[model samples]
Target: MPVRILDSRDHVLRRKTIPMVKILWKNQDVESATWELESVMRKAYPHLLLPIERLIPFSGFCW
Candidate 1:
């Protein structure tokens, strides 16, 4: 899967209220990806809120 992340400041629809972390995943097989991400997030940032951006495909880069 290809993943891309953009900072809140770089997001197109920037919101001033909450800081955001964007996550994109490609070729993601449902269960494993979700669980893996959740596990990582739970351990890494236990308190901060994070929203995941689903299924973003690579447009201009090589794998």
Candidate 2:
């Protein structure tokens, strides 16, 4: 079955987590980099991985 980013576990993790990824602390521009990467990924596999801003309940994530 195809797994959606809105999976329950992903939802909880994203909501509770702040930095999201531990390595984010290592880079000041990690946030911007993340957006860049996500943008490329979404374009490449738009159906497989949706945008993070689209939460599960309200709007969701994948790792």
Candidate 3:
């Protein structure tokens, strides 16, 4: 499960673009965070995306 969302960006493909987010997982270090598809996270872990502003307070991070 995700502990919080750290950042977000768009992935460009040959014919399309996919929204992605950097996810901080439970019991993991900040350096271990991974990028996941925004759509998938929204479906599986909606709560994590709901309070995005509150979750990412660090400078240089955007959601």
RMSD of each: 11.9, 13.4, 6.6
Instruction: For residues 1-63, write the lDDT of model 3, one tens digit per residue.
Output: 899889999999999999999999999999999999999999999887776578667588477
- Give the per-residue lDDT of model 2 (tens digit) for 1-63: 222222221213544632211122223443432222333445655765645556455423555
Best by TM-score: 3
User: Model 3: how far is 41 from its true place, Å?
Assistant: 0.5
Best by lDDT: 3
Score every model by TM-score. Answer: 0.22, 0.24, 0.75
Question: Which of candidates 2 and 3 reaches a greater TM-score?
Answer: 3
Can you write out model 1's per-residue Cα lDDT over 1-63, one digit (the tens) per residue? 325432232223455333244444476543333223434444565543333423455468687
Q: Candidate 3 lDDT (Cα, whole model)? A: 0.91
Report the Cα lDDT for candidate 1: 0.40
**Order of the predicted models by lDDT, top scorer first:** 3, 1, 2
Q: Is candidate 1 or 2 superior in TM-score?
A: 2
Please give the distance, in angstroms, between residue 11's alpha carbon in candidate 1 and its true position after superposition. 10
The models' CA-based lDDT, in order, is: 0.40, 0.36, 0.91
Pairs that collide, model 1: none
